[model samples]
Target chain A: MVTMRDVAREAGVSKATVSYVVSGSSLISEKTAAKVRAAMEKLGYSVNHTARALSTAKTNAIGVVTSFRNNGACFDLSAGAYLYGIAAAARRHGYDTMLLTGDDGVEAIRSAALSRRVDGVVVLDVLIGDARVGALKESGIPAVMLGSPADSQGVDVVDSNFEAAAVSLVERLYDHGHRSILFIGWPEAVYERKLNYAVRFRASLMEACAMRGLRVGAVYAHDATLGASEVIPRALRDCPSATAMVIHNDAAVVGAPQAFERTGIRVPADLSVVTVMPDQLGEGMQIPFDSVGIDVDAVASHTVDRLVERIGDPEMSARVELLDQPMHVRGSVRAAHED
Target chain B: MVTMRDVAREAGVSKATVSYVVSGSSLISEKTAAKVRAAMEKLGYSVNHTARALSTAKTNAIGVVTSFRNNGACFDLSAGAYLYGIAAAARRHGYDTMLLTGDDGVEAIRSAALSRRVDGVVVLDVLIGDARVGALKESGIPAVMLGSPADSQGVDVVDSNFEAAAVSLVERLYDHGHRSILFIGWPEAVYERKLNYAVRFRASLMEACAMRGLRVGAVYAHDATLGASEVIPRALRDCPSATAMVIHNDAAVVGAPQAFERTGIRVPADLSVVTVMPDQLGEGMQIPFDSVGIDVDAVASHTVDRLVERIGDPEMSARVELLDQPMHVRGSVRAAHED
Candidate 1:
């Protein structure tokens, strides 16, 4: 309950000097700042953030609106990594993150902004034509979307280019002399929800395959029901001539070794396997496979940077940013002629 | 910036009535509350949370302090699950979670509490003799610990009983006529940090093995350098007679199939495997294995409940609650006689 006045008196300085030091103002001399800090420590004086926020009309907090609907027993690894990146970056900028996980993302975001609980907001798991985008624009809050919506009007967007990764992955497989390929996608539910990343990846991969005049087959693998074990064999059976497989599902990729073992398929011998997922997930897989590594940290870091900039200058123009990740060739692809 | 007075004048009600409605007080009549709400909507009068917090001395936000140091490219699934649970629960109680992740946990916690940025705090990944425990106690804040420290004087704790799970796993293995067992634990770095869960699990497992007079060999597996592929083979070589294995590492359990395939050790054929992990992780494994299922949701839910309670009534007594999780017997373990 010690106030700044008590510290100022103890340090033999004016109250304005104590305030300047507490607010990190560069106007104060180093000696004066040190004296104020020492007095604050001795008097156990701490700044009341609420009162300061009221006076400055700014809260050193960011609202992070994310959805956990798709998460199963195991939380989504990619989402978790992005969240870690955001929290770390926010801390570096002297901000805390207020996590808002209400099922209705638009309402959650709108409320946070209207209440002035945070200076800016970060939206995660953006869907095609997401309602949150409209809400954010209407709220007039400095906002950033971790995933791109089909139509983003006023918010900055930072996301991994899954569409590019998908297209590039197909080209790599085709260059390996693989004429026919089987593409395993995420659960039907994900696409049904109109999640931008999965839908975009599937469309881009198919477009790339058609342009190459390559024979391709596709199947949707559900995490709970149609897992890798069932999806992998069914795709192979339907496309008997397929010599390679491209999996865009994290669970399917993690479970690939078991699927191949049960179906009696040898990697790079009978079939070539490539996955499009974050490198973090690929590293955890029991067997290494060729992958287009999505850098979740990069996307998150950029989103935070843009949002912080917009918060500082609300007139900053909004733009879309799609980061290109690396392609890791871990010897899981084989030449069709050799096979 | 429409103020409460604007809404009050538009509604033809007293400013105090609008204040009561904004604070969610039941003293306001339903008709007056409806009028105030309609006026607020028409005038676009949003509550200024900072000003309200200065007057009411409540933020309706909880601070969640967690560490991500152990995470590699992939985030820890269990920690992520716990975080999701806490956020979901907090939202249900009309509270947002303020995530504070700093390497110096004590400083992060003390700053959040002393600044009154949150109504309460929930600390994750508590270490043995954690410095944060002392800081929290000294700060005299309403706090809860998701993991128990060796000396928790003034905090409520909610954690899964890893010691009990370890003891039960050993007993189950022993009952299957296994004498010698190989136990692979988390990375050496985790133990070096004195993480409460890993340190407690290892100690309890060793203690239980001794009680049953079972021969056990232990090794620390690092996620980066000494991964499962290297640790599993080395442990097998050192404990050649080991007919059973208890793995307390998530990465090691995940990579068991690859290690077994390379080492020519078949599950339930050459060795029986039992893992100590959350059921969420157990379900994600390509190969299902025997495991003690840690209910991360239950722990997180209880921790939030207690923390909220303490926030509401600061005089609430502190107590420790250890949740007993279920054991799942998959096809990974087999009788030694059958082998």
Candidate 2:
């Protein structure tokens, strides 16, 4: 196998120069860097990551605890996209991700935490009182969650402002002359579990309706996508007075418009629709729905920053960061009828 | 720090008994197992995974390398589903999954492979003559790839029979009285990168056409989802003699029928369309085209099996496995002259 010595010999440079080029520490001339790269490629030299990590005590890897198993269901596309975003951001920061799933409730988290397999962890689909957070804290493993803040001390959290985003969607509908609007959301079991964001969404929508004196028609979807078809029709049938709808689920937002079209309902003409989660609904899918847009990239980048901070300074106090969600009006929503 | 001692104390048993119960090494009474589980849960005691792995040199974590970074650039739904399947299978076998992207490349694969971070890796979206493969092999790491047999050496591979599937699709079209059929595929750069699947697909279709003494029309999709507005009209104008279309791209199949509809052409009646990829097109999409079905579950399960085998016995010779693709005749393809 080609090593640093081989590259150094091929480049006619000292072994230290080759090491400096590979480590990317200290200044090296661009000319020398190119020479080193060419020589390394020619010699088929690849880094010995195990030896490197052992020597440096830095694998440049971030453990990602995807807690879908504890949540007892598959994460929908939007959730999956959020994870992909986190992984992408970690990669940009010169870190790779290690995924932890059902092992969240057991020794899995602690083992990964203590083994120094990762510099820190980016926890996804986190529950409000996740045990892994406690385990990570006890093990002194720096951690950040992509969902609602866990109460564990010293853990950093980056999450969307679910309550604020939901309220903004409701307020946008009101501003658009919508007096009677329907709120399509995830199941009640999700909220009952105190999954902070889900509960917050429900509370914010209800509070927004009460403050505005608007007739809020709320329907809890059975599952993410399948329920959209069933619940939308029932919401329309039960409350024929509703002129607009706000969806918090991504799958439902993508599927609802098609469901409405199948039922011969023209969007914004017969009924208007809007979504709070917009990342997974691609323009190519052609749903054309308006949205309360949470910048997925922002959330991902912020989470990486927080995790990196915690990794560097594990003794820092627990911090919670909430990103703002902006509203993007598209073709699916319109002014409500004023008779 | 609840440990085996705590479980033993609570369960009124010895530490070895607790160990046996936790590891399931020896057959223990169900009543004793329940007692240990209850005691462990009550005392918040979980196994010490780090110590165990240090002694055994095994971490029940597998790495999944995917193309999440190239999301919109490629229709990665099939790839995503395959990763999900690997995760599910890993869980069933008492393992967790770690996700690694291309950004980290050799370092990530090597660290995850050798530092006992992951027991094995399932490499997806592998290019022909990949450097990562060579790196993994050099490090004596167990690995599997989701690509063709040609690209792999002494490494297990799980892939679809792209050439045979494409030929079968062409044969179906010919059987339906279509003399001229156009094959829309991924960009030529993908083929040039020696992905070879697309190249094989085209070759098979050409061979099939030659066997039937017919000339097959073909087009290269600039993107995964061929926008019918651009490609379909161009195909029609360029090959007006063509009566049928076969799409290997998933997203293109979703939109091709709509492009035909917009041009006042009926599906199967005006232009018959068949896709090589079958997921994502079956339901809830605008264009429901016929397909040469690729079994996503089979691909996922078989890859997992190979990965597990490689992890268990790293010195075993690598093998390639290909799953069968069946044809699903939907409304998109029909007897061509019937229109």
| Residues B123-208 of candidate 1: C-alpha lDDT, one tens digit per residue | 98889778999889998888999987887896898898988999999999999999899998877777778888888899999999
Candidate 2 structure quality by residue, lDDT tens digits, A1-339: 466788899999998899899889989999999999999888767765545665576767787776553232323445545667777888788786766655444465676665566778887767777776777678777788777744745577788888788787888788888888888877666665666677677788889888999898888776443446567888888998999988776556655754574466778898878787744345434446787776777888899988887778767788888787777777777788886
At residue B161, candidate 2 shows an lDDT of 81
Which digits, one per residue and each the tens of the lDDT, describe model 2 over residues B74-102? 53445445655677788778776777765
TM-score of model 2 (CA atoms): 0.75
Residue range A44-79, candidate 1, lDDT tens digits:
889999988998989989989987556433236566
Kindly report the TM-score of the first chain in candidate 2: 0.84
Which candidate should be chosen as best, given TM-score against the real structure? Answer: 1
Clashing pairs in 2: A99-B98
DockQ, every prediction: 0.51, 0.19
